[model samples]
Structure formats: C-alpha cells, structure tokens
Target chain A: MGGSLLEQLPLFLSYSNVSFLAQAFGVTVALSIVGCVVGYTVGALLAFIRNRHVVDVLPARFLSVGFSETFRRVPFLVKLMVVFFAFEVVGMRVSMFTVTATTVALAAAAFSAEIMRAGLEALPESQWDAAESMNMGGVMSLRLWALPQSWKVILSPALSFTVGLIKSTSIASQISVFELTYAAKVLNERGFSPVLSFGSLLVLYFLICYPLNLYARRLERQLERPRGWKSGAPLLAESEAA
Target chain B: MHYLEIDRFTASYDGKEQVLVDVSIQIAKGEIISLIGPSGSGKSSLLRGLMGLLVPQSGEVMLDGEKVDYTNRKSVKALRERLAIVFQQYNLFQNMDALRNVTVAPVKIRKRNAREVEEEATALLRKVGLGDKLHAYPDELSGGQQQRVAIARALALKPDILLLDEVTSALDPELVSEVLDAIRILAAEGMTMLMVSHEMALVREISTRVVMMDRGRVIEEGSADRIFDNPRTRRCQAFVGKILSH
Candidate 1:
C-alpha cells in the first residue's frame, strides 16, 4: 500500500514535453504582464477621476463610483465567462487570449483604484497647503507632492494584487487557452496520472510567485520607521553638526 | 497705500459656524504683522483667506492696489506666487531630499532655469543653517530641522509676503527656539510677513503690528509694545496675562 518514488518518476517523466509546457508557461506570463500593466494604468486614471472634487459635477461623480463598484462586486470567473461568451452575441468575435486578459485587467483596475484612492486620501491637508502656497496647486501639486507620497502606500498592495492575478490566470485554462494549468490538464488526460501532473503544476506556480511575495515583504519593511527615524545612519550629515 | 490690503474678508468652514467675520487688515511694506488669538478664534482663517486656500463668502485681497480675483485660477496662481506659507507642521515634501524639496516648485512651476534655482536653493538652505543636511529626507530630520527646511522652501519662491500659520506650534519645546531663531533672522533682514502665532514672546519681539482676534472679529489692533504692555480690551488683557503667566 506504500507509494514508491520509482513508480511516480516515470509518470511525471512521461508527460514532460519541454516545448509544449514552455509554450503554455510563456502564454500565462504574457497574459499576467499585459493584465497588470494595463490594469494599473487604468486604475490610476480611475483613482484620479474619483478624486476630482474640484470639478465634481453630479453625473461624472456617479459614473466613476458606479463603474468601479460594479467591477469590484463581480466575481472574476463570472466576469471572464461573460466577456468570453457575451461578445459573440453582439456579433463580435474576440480571441480567447484577448478575452482572458481583458477580464483580468478590468478586475485588477477596480481593486487598484480603491487602493490608490485610499493611498492618496491618507496624506495630510498641509501637504496640499504647502504646495498651493508655493504656487504649485492643482494637478501640478498632486503630481509632485501628493502622488509621490502615495506610492509607498500603493506599491505593496499593487504587487500582491499582481501575484493574485498571476495565479488567477489558471482560470483562463477553462476557456481552453493552453496556459500552464490547461497544459497540465492535457498531460493528465493523456497519461491517466492525476497526482503527478497536478503536483508538478503546483510546484511551477510556487516558483513563479514566491520571489514576488518576498519582494513585497521587503518593501513593507522599508516603510516602517521607528520614532520617525528610518533604518541606517542619516544619509548626509554636515561634519560639524549632530 | 497699504502694500497688501484685506478688505471685509469673511470665512466659514461649515455653513452653521462662522469662523471669521468681516475681518479687515492692512500692511505697509516690510511690516511683520502677527495675528494672536485663542484657539478657534479664526486667526488661521484670516491667514487662509490671505493665501487663497480658503474662499471668502464676501471679501477681497488686494496686492499693491490690484484686486486679486480669487475665483479665477490664473489670478489666484499669480497671487500665490507672490505669497508663500509655512505651516505649523512644516509640511516638507518627504519624497525628496532637503535641497530638492526647496528646488522643485521653482524649477517645475515657474519654469525657471534648473541650475540657477538649484544654486539659489543651496544658498537658501545654507542661510537656514542646513548647509550640511542637503540630502537628508524629512524623516531623517528633527522637527526643528524639518521646519527650517520648510522655511527655506518658502524663501526659495521669493514671495513678496510670507505667511506663517503657527509655524512653531508643532515642535517640541526644546525645538521651537531653533525655528523661531530662523524667523528672527528673516525679521532682521526686513522680510514682510503675516504670521499666526501663540508664542507671545516671539510675536512681541518680531511683530511691527499685532492684532488680537476673538469670535471671528478683530478685538484689538496696535503696536506689539502696546498690545503686550497696555492692552485696551478686557479680552486682550486677559489673554496676554494668561499667556505671560504661563
């Protein structure tokens, strides 16, 4: 009744076609990169739109709040299925890759817009006052002072969200997009070995996401300062001063 | 003519409460006008009104006989370039080092020569006695140092009038004097300033004219010597007595 390493080795080796797995892995990565970059840009723009109290008329405010909320409430799987299938109803035929990437990007933008809004709001009013007094009010003030301070608040969460998006790419396999998970499913179907094929797939995902998690944690550590003092000696001190 | 005139300015935060009511003030060239009042007395509202950070329900700020149209963005921006403010909290830009914090607005917004602005910023930092801490971020500096950097940044704009809103109020007791000392230096050099301060001693020493405010109105206006020594109103006398005793 004991499981032997020798028996498992052949099962794993039998499905290891270098070219096929490599192609699937490449597609999965490309999808995630495209999703995150486009997602963050759109999300940042949405954050700005939602924050526009200066010119905030009723219609613009409602539209921004409504769109972000709707996207945030919808589940990613449902969103993906809707995009993949619904377009055909309107006489539009989009690629499986395009559909998957678009769905992930939309989901990511909703989440990130909220994160960026929170980050921007956390800044003190004095930051704006100081900029305005120096004749640097409006968009110039937001760009130079407010936005830069918000990056530390935005970066770690954004990166963690990106990792989640990468994992969620496996869902795209349901559309038969032939990313990593779909590749594993194909191998398992052919070889009649569920445990070996799926376990290796798990290992491959861990390999992709672990370093990202590490980097995010490192960034978080850099953000913490004790008694308003950052780690390490003061960067540039006059020789005579304390 | 008054160099800067604030005529019948009124300000409120929420509709329910009036923070400042029909406040008028005038300053000649090179006058250090200090606004002294108890908390919630609208000393800051007056300064905010002057900076165009707060819109007045009914009032006007005139600079050198020209009416400033606060509603117009171009007018306000042009007005603000001639006026700079340093807050009680310092509000230094944490993203950049000390030198860059002072240099950013001049180079970016004013479209000034970067090299010229950098050199002037360096000189300004040295004037504030931060000659050695040019590259230090706000987190790395003490409250006094950060406040000093803020002062230098304000000076870099070359404003015709400087507004300081309780600049030293946020500092630790020991740190307050260093910031006050920097202000003292500016006063000696004849910088025109309008300040809201609770530091009576510094205010008395630095102000050419001092105004006492209460309940959104100017209660008393006189020379600093008279206000501190012989206050006319019961409120001014009581306020001065209470602060001096402390």
Candidate 2:
C-alpha cells in the first residue's frame, strides 16, 4: 500500500522547496571551489617550509608543528566552532561565506602539508645530486624538476583528500552556512520524511564525490604505465647499439 | 705544471673521521688516470671534493695552475661546465627522455639554443651507441644503456675532463662490457679522465697511470702494468691480489 522509495523521489522533486534545494546546491559548489583554491595556496606555502627545513627557527617550527597537529587532532566541527566563536569575539561581523571558506581552507591546509611532505620524502636522493652536478641552484632545481615530480607522486592522495574535504564542508552548516546538509535538515524538520531527506542527502554526497574518485583512479592507472610504451623497448635496444 | 692539481686535501662527512686525508694528485692535459681502492677507502670522496661537492678542510684545488674559488658562484659554474661526471647509478633524470636529459644542462646552464643542443646531444648519444633511444625515459633502459646515456649527457657540455665514478659497478655482468666499451672509445679519443673503479682489467687496459689508495691515503702510484703485475707496497700487492682473485 505504501509507495516505494523511488516513487517518493518524484513527489520530493515536485516539492515547493525545490528552489531552496537549488540554492543549497549552489552554495555547496561555491564553498568547495573557494575553500579548495584558498586552501591549496596556503597549503603550498606551508609545504615549502616543511620541505626546505626553513622551520629551523624554534618559534617558527613550533608554530607550524602546533598548527598542523592541532587541526589534525580536533574534529572539523570543533574547528568551525572555534573559528566562528573567535571571530565573533573579535567583533568582526564576517559573512557566513567568509567564515565557512576560511575555516575549511585552514583545516584543509594542514592535511595538504602532510600529503606533500610524504611525496617529497619519497623522491630519490640521486635527483638532488643530479641537479647539483648540473650546477642548478636550490630554487631552480625545485622549480624545474623536484616540485613537478612531487606533484605527480602526490596527485592521487591529494585528490582523495579533496573529496574528504568536500564532505567535511557539510559541517560548516552547523555555523549557519546554509550549505546542502543545512537545507536538508531544515526541510526534514518541516514534515518531510526523515528517511527520504537523509537518504537523498547521502545520495547527493555520493553523486558529487564518486566521479572525482573515479577520475583520480583513472589517472593513477595511466601514470603507472610508462607514457608511450609502444616504442620503448626497441628504442632502448637501438640506443644501446648507437 | 699540471692542468688540475689537488694538494694536501683533507675532508670528512660529519667532520669527525676523515674520508680523504692529506691526498695529493695531479691530472695532465690529456691523460687517463685510474684510482683503485677498496670500498669506503675515499676514492669517490676525492672525486666529489674535486667537484666542489665536498670542500676539503685544509687544502687547495688548483685549476690551470690557479686556485679555484669554490665560494664564487660564477667561477664554480664555469668550472663545472668544464667538468662532467658519470655516476655509478647513472643518475639520469628519470622524468626526461634520454635526449632531453642530455641536452638540459647545456641549454639551461650554457645558454645554448635548445635545437642546437639537441643536435649535439644526438651526436653524443650516437657516439655512446644510443642514437635510437633518444626519446626513451631512463626507467625504460637497461643499466648499461642508462650508463651510456649518462656518458652522452656528460659529453654534451664538451667538458675538459671526465670523472667516472665506478660507472660499471651497478651493471649486470653482461651489461658491464657495453658501458666499458663506451668508456674505451672515450679513452681512445684522448679525453682526460679520472676514474674510480673496481674493474682491474679495464683499468689495466685503459689507464695510463694507476693510483692505489688504502685507508684514506695513496699507497702507491705508477704505470698500470707495474701496479697490477708487481705492486711495491704490501697493502697495494694485497689489494691487487684480492681483486685479481675475484
């Protein structure tokens, strides 16, 4: 006698709150894009310090170590609360957009630094020796080769982290950012069935995250195979004869 | 007067135990010298010191009879352009194709046109017997092939002297001959060379002079025949005997 979950989807689609849902989608997309861009810029700077051992200054090293550890250890919700509360205390009446972006970016940067450090450490020492032998200076060597190679190594992990960051952005709703989860919560409280509301939110998160995960995996597969493999073996033999 | 001279050179990696101590050597304009020693006996350290990768604690490295100013960047770059090293590990940039790897420093550091550098790199690769493999990455090549490409890369700059650091040590037995053949051709062309290696047969055949090192010191130096057939120092004789046995 009860309609199936699939039948309920059409009813949900025709719900009067469809415009609100569309607005929530827009906010979610904007928050993720802005958060990732700002996060990557700040993270890259932090990664440089971690890579170059520039954190040699005791205070600077302490700050970096403390910032990374504190963010990593605390829950994302806690970070959002702290950031929002701290800004409120300072009497800076910032918009929810600014607060959400800043909180997510700061949290994302700590994780990015760790990912980059692992990538850097995986590089062979011989790369440095080769660069030095060619008389390449420190900055030029990093710019020309080291950074590019490190990016290749970290690509998959970085992409996965980005997906995690997208899901975590849901927590920003707790601070009244009105992102996807916030809209779903408001709708569910208004007599929409809890199962349908929560289930759709779960489906939305999967739809957003799945394609990116597949793309990252595809790239990893492509990278694992040497580029232009068809001519590789014979070319090796020919070079030996030359 | 020698073209390059290292006098009373003393160096160590952590400044505690010495790796190269009170070592002196002279390289002539167009002669091949081989340095043979047991592992960890400072042969590679001496070469690295000459390249300014490791600065000696108390000594002088004179190039063309003038003290080399390692502190000066321009001077160091100039010196490096005239000197090229082939490492045991080949050390080719794995990301680059063979031709690009060979041409990179020449084009970037020497301000040469990339197209012109590519032509030179092609010729050098051909000389090392790798003409067809220009576009292959280092990971795709065999150890011998990679080492030969390394030789080509070194030659691309037209260096005044070539330093070979156990170039064939990392190769399989079957692959060693190919790399050695490339080195033999380089020797025939009268390239001034300083080689640190364990291949006694190759050293005896190609080296004009052999320097036998032991415990951070040159225990003996003379013609390769004398060093191999009839070493004078007890240490030299024993070292040679052990290598010959293997």
Candidate 3:
C-alpha cells in the first residue's frame, strides 16, 4: 500500500511521471481542437445543405437531418462505443485516440449544425425577400447580408459549445486514449494519491477552458457592437447623435 | 410593345391558395400606375409575383420584348437587371448605414464602379431629402427617413420601372407626409412607377392610371378620376364609396 498522500508527492512529481502526464495533457488538447475544427466545418455544411434557401435536393436535406437527429440523441459514451465496434466490424485497425477523436467530431457536427441552422433561420423573411428581388444568388446573399447579420448569433454559442466540447474530451480516457481522465487513473493506480492525480485534471481542464470561454465572450461583445455605434447611448430618432 | 406587359399572371404564396389570379396590366414608358385595393386584395402580391419572389405558377410577363421566364436563370437575371422594388417595410440591411444601403446593390450586384455609385447614391439620398442622414443606420432614422433611404437604394439601381409597395403606409401619421414628399419628387421627374398606395389624394395626383382589385382580380381600371369617381363595377363603386367617405 502507498503511504499517506504526502509520502507519494515526491514520486508523483518525478520527471518521468510529469512527462507522462504532459503527454496525456497534449492528447486531450489535440483531441478537442482537431475534433472541434473538423466538426464546425462539416456542421456548417450540413446546416447549409439542409437549408431550403440554399439547397432544393430532397435526399441531401433528408440525409443531413437524419444524421443530426440520430447523433444528437445518442449518449456520448454510446457513440464512442459504436464507432469503436463499427471499426472492428469493418476489420480496420486504428488507435483508440483516433476512434475517440472521430466520435468527438461526429458529435460536434450534429450539435453545431442545429446551432447554425437556428441562427440562419432566425433572420426575417424580409431579408431574404430583399436579396431575392435583387437576384443575388445564395452565396452572394449570405456574404452580403445573412452572414454579417447572423455571425453574432452563430458564433457566440458556437465558441461556448467549443469549451463544453473540450470538457467532453475527458470522456475519451474511457477508451484508453491517455487523455486527462485516463492519465489521472493511471497515476492513481501507480500509487499516487487520488487527490493528487484527479486534482491535477480539475486544474488542467480549467486551464484549457477558461481562456477559451473568455475569448468567446470578448468576441461576442465585439460582434454585438457594430462600428460607429456608441456604447451605452440611447437609440435616437431623426436626430444626430454626433 | 409596351414598356412592361403582364398577362394572365397568377401566383400563390403556397402552392394551394392563389394570392393573385389572372391579373393583367400594361404600362408605357414614363407612366405612373397605382394599384389601389382593399387589404389582402393582392396589390403587394402582384408586385412580389412580378419580381419572381412568389413564383408565378401560370403567367407571361414581357419587358421590352423579352419574356421573363422565371424558371430560367438568364431570363430572371435580365428581368431583375431592369427592374427594382422598394418594399413597404423599408427592408434596409440592418448591418449597413444609410449610404451603404443605397450603394450596395449597384456596386456589388451590378459591378458598377464604387466611387461612381457612391456619388450617385449621395445624390439620390439628397434627392429624397435625406442628405443629412447619409451616415445613419436604419434604426437610427425615423420611419419617414428610412423609407426615403429605401427609395434612394432602389433609385440607385436605375431600374427601367420602379415598384413601390405601400412605401409610406408603415410610417406614423405625421411621418407620412415626409415620405410622400419624397415620392412627389420622383413623380415630378416622370419616373416610370407601379405603386400600391393607401393615400388616395397622392394616387389621384400622380397616377396616369388606377387599377382596382378585389378577391385577387382586377375588377375595374381607368384614369384615377374615372375609377375613383365613376367606377363601373358595383363592387368597385361600393369600395370606392367607402374609401372616398373616409
């Protein structure tokens, strides 16, 4: 049996153990970022494909809708297991990290697609009508008006979702991917105190997520205030605020 | 050929309920024709359908000898290039200021020189009496001012015919005159316009012709005086009598 927690402190802080934990930390970060980046790109595509204003193909719309609805309803661990077993059934040999990362991206795509669709749909019909009357194509309409107007709606929630996604990456450890939670478990089994190992995860996760959440807030504030608008000024009527 | 010709045009908001049914009209160059009808009488739907916003299920529109096939990309493109519309709600891009709202379509869609478009847009805003409010956003302006900016935006496109859909109806009672004054400025220049208006006095003053609609059909049409003072159809007479008494 390992001695009291204080006695294990030296061993836990040993250079080799620190390096092992460092590698686990790196895996967690890489998994979250790569998965989320892929998720956002594909999710935005899914949202547009399903959008009636942009696409008219019935099958394409149905497929995206089905994918989003199916994946969003599934539990995260269940999704990881499904991906893992599906790869096994296909006779593909892949790393546990790859399996979990793919699950993160798939989950992200489904969730973010709904976020994007909500933002795009919230725009008034008049905005689209005005664009259509001018004969602006879908791309041109999005570029000129819809995107500029909807970015605040799309981006704030998306970035906040990213922070939540980073937390969800801890679940990857269950697949033996050596992410934060797995790193903590391995350390605890190797005679480090549970407090020392698990406590480190709480700190590291906070470190990874706090700045991202702050950045999201800052970006939201920037988008909310259009150029030439004075902060805290009352809306004027036919009078020069200048 | 007439400057604009719409024949037997029929359309529905949904595929089921026809908003405009067998509507027909003709306009020569430099004529201002007003569509005056009861609410939900398809005045706005006619303008929207003509622009291919509502998708005409069955109709033929010929503009300057080129038939607009709304299903065909090139035909719709050619149609839009020659026509512009000002919505009743003054649907300015909320992200843009008044000047940018006026200049965006010409510079972006038409690929006009930006500098030239800016100058023309400035002049157009000035023509509509919003010279001082060029930098203001839509929300920053009064309802009357926003409508004028919308007018400037449509004018900057230099459409062969402008369709104004109740341009001043959304304004407050006091604000209505300012927007109407701007329309009078356009009328004085002899701009070809198809307008839907609740302002009977202005319609009578500027319309070369007036068409009355009820239940999605053009029931009566003639000079503003003939339609307003001496309508032929009993329904039109009752409608005009109700409007005139107000």
lDDT (Cα, tens digit) per residue for candidate 2, span A80-157: 888788889999999988888888888778887777767777777766776777787656666656666666677799
Question: Which digits, one per residue and each the tens of the lDDT, describe model 3 over residues A13-38?
Answer: 88998898889899999999888988
What's the candidate order when arranged by decreasing TM-score? Answer: 3, 1, 2
Tens-digit lDDT string for candidate 2 (B59-105): 77888877877767677777787788888898877667888788777
Any idea how many clashes model 1 has?
A: 0
**What does the lDDT come to for candidate 1?**
0.82
Q: Weakest 10 consecutive residues, lDDT, candidate 1 chain A?
A: A231-240
CAPRI quality of model 1: acceptable
**Candidate 1: regions farther than 4 A off:** A1-8, A11-16, A53-61, A222-242, B14-16
Specify the highest-TM-score model's number.
3
In candidate 1, which residue pairs clash? Answer: none
Instruction: Please give, for residues B93-184, the per-residue lDDT of candidate 1 as tens digits.
Output: 77778888887878777777666777898888898889999888898899999999999999989999999989988889999988898999
| Residue A74 miss distance in model 3 (angstroms) | 1.2
Better of 2 and 3 by TM-score: 3
Best by lDDT: 3
Q: What is the TM-score of chain A in candidate 2?
A: 0.82
- In candidate 3, which residue ranges exceed 4 Å CA deviation? A89-91, A225-242
